[model samples]
Target: MSRPAVLAARLRTAAWLGWQIEANWADPFTFIVYSAVRPLATALILAVMYRAVAGIASSGQAFLGFYVANAFHEYVIRVLVGMGWVIVEEREEFETLKFVYTSPIGMFTYLWGRSSVKFVQASLSLLLILTTGWLILGLRWDWGAVRWLPLLLSFVLGLIAIVYFGFFVAGWALVLPRAAISVNEGVAAALTLLCGVIFPIDLLPRAVQVVAMLLPFTWWYEALRRFLIGHGASARLSSFSDGALLAALAVSTALFSCVSVWGYGVLERRARQNGKLDQARLF
Candidate 1:
């Protein structure tokens, strides 16, 4: 096959594998139900906690808006992490690591296709959360006021950044199966606390705020929030301008992509040298 044809075939295979995994695991209704319930339940719990801490009456619209917006962003992060975990699960539980490691299309391309499918799934989950929040929790956003062009651009850039982040995590999963679990969990937790998901980044300590600015999640969340809500509502902890934030996101995504590619190469080399690709456990 031609190089482009081979690449297309591999991507198609990756997407098909993703669909089969989803279908075999659960029916459409069940998948939809779980996705809707899990995020919504978590959001409601957080809403109650926020109200308890800040006082329901005192918290007001601004708090609710931020919370709801953050909840949606959090769902996106979780789904992205979940995409990495799917790769890990296939390696460990299904014992398919060897085949994937030796595939003609390469592990990196396979993961890209799989994560692309997860991105679509996660987008659906985000829509569901938004609709549920609007109906059940009285969450409101002025859809008409939003700059649609910029918002679409932001969504594309943000999702691409996040999908690349998933690819990075997938590389870790390839080599450090057990550690990858903790890594994914730690990342999710850290982003929640540091990325201005549920709270303004400015509220975090100066040292922590500095760290948060280095992460793509912080910028992605801020950009999405700014587009969805407004600049005033999505205030940053750092003194960076809007142009700076977008530029950081682009740079961060590109950096992570390079790192992920390098990491995959390292894992492949190590696996070949140590004969660990087919081994059930490293430790």
Candidate 2:
């Protein structure tokens, strides 16, 4: 087979493997129910907490809209972290790391395919959550008024950037399995707090806001809110122009991809050389 054909074949197999991983664990109905229910429940808890702290009435349409949009962004972080941790789960729980490492399909390709499945699953969950928020929490949006082109562009770029970020974290699973979960959680929390998932970045300390600007997800979320809700949703972060945001996304994608590839290659080589593919270690 040609190089491209071989790569395509591997990706197809990896995708099938990813699908089976989820499908074999639960029926379609159960999967759908769990996905929808879990995030909605979490959003409710978050809403209550916000209302209590901010003293905002539940009936306030403005707060509801902001909360739902933030919650949706939070869901994106959840998906990214979950997909990244799957590598650790496969190695530790499923005991498939050795087999996977020995397979002809490369680790990068396998993870890419698996994360694609996660992206689709997360997208569905986003829709369900948005619907539930609209019906139950009275979160209102003029969906028809949204700028479709910019919204779609931001979503696509954000998704790609986040997936690469996940892959970068997945590399840690290979080298430091014990720390993977903690590291993943920490990264998720940092991104959530810094990327304005639940509030405007300006609400954070100025130093933190500066740090947030260095992260790709900050620009992605800003662009998303701007496009989806309107300029007012992200007007506070006026430092980032649309062109700058797009450039940041592109640079972030490239950087994370390079890091993930290099890190995975290093870990894989070490594991093979030391015959530690199945060995559990902290370092």
Candidate 3:
């Protein structure tokens, strides 16, 4: 398939998988209830923090905006990672590792569907969260519509990179269980801290700020901040620093995802051949 066609196929497959998952547990109220708790907690925390930093002007909105932005970005990443968790959990729980190894559909396709489903569900939750922020917290969607498009595209692309990173970690989960969750949570927290989710990274130690620049997340938030703040002193990062790094991260993630998928295929096949498939079974 051509590149566009391939991406389309993958997206289509993912959407279909998403529909399947939705159908399995089709309760809107349940979804809403489950999704609301975290954002509510976040709002309370925001109130406390803003109180502590009294008299700040746009920074309040900036902090709130960054929190919402991070919440939005994290929804996608969590979905990507959660899908892998499902598969690994199933393998350990059900003793069906052998079945997974022998399944005709490629493992990547299965994982793609799982991740895609989570992404869709989380997207819905994010829509609700953003809407709440706009209505209650007074977040103004004042940016020119056309100007925001690039940032939106960049955000989605950043998510693509995040999903690939999840797949990469999922590969690790197969061989190293204890280390996987620790690594996953550690990276997630570190990225959130580094990306200026709660506060601007510049206020931190200079060394930490430099490290944050290397992450895809910095690009993601910077794109959103630019859209919200417009062209100004707030937009400190250059096109080369933010835009270039995001593009590089996307490319790196795609390459790693492909490699991880290939590795998983090999491991599954070998496990099947060696009578160790049961050891890796989906629960």
Question: Global CA lDDT of candidate 2, please?
Answer: 0.70
Candidate 1 wrong stretches, greater than 4 Å: 25-30, 56-59, 74-79, 232-240, 271-273
Q: Which candidate is the best by lDDT?
A: 2
| Candidate 1 lDDT, 1-283, residue by residue in tens | 8999999999988888887776456587877665567777767776777778866631355665566556657445555686567656776778887777676777767877776666666666777767766787776778877877666766777677666667667656666666777877876777788877777778899898888877766777777766676653445533567677678877876676577567667766765677656656533
Model 2 misplaced stretches (Cα beyond 4 Å):
25-33, 58-71, 232-235, 263-276, 281-283
Cα lDDT tens digits, model 3, 1-283, are: 7876775676576568556644456786765555565655565466456656654442355555565665565454456567556455546755554464466445566566667767766776677666666676665556454366666776676776666666655655555544556555666677767767666777768898777766666666666665555431123454445456456556645665576567666655554555543454332
Model 1: lDDT of residue 266: 76
- The whole-model C-alpha lDDT of candidate 3 against the native structure comes to 0.59
Which of 1 and 2 is ahead in TM-score? 1
Which parts of model 3 are misplaced by more than 4 Å?
A: 1-30, 53-59, 94-97, 143-146, 228-283
Superposed on all Cα atoms, the candidates' RMSDs to the truth, in angstroms, are 2.9, 3.1, 4.9
Residue 126 of model 2, lDDT score: 76
lDDT of 2 by residue, 114-216 (tens): 7766666677777777777778877666788788887788777777767666766776666666777788888887887888776778788889878877777
- The residue-level lDDT of candidate 3 at 152 comes to 70
What is each predicted model's overall lDDT from 0 to 1?
0.68, 0.70, 0.59
Candidate with top TM-score is: 1
Error of 1 at 257 (Å): 3.2
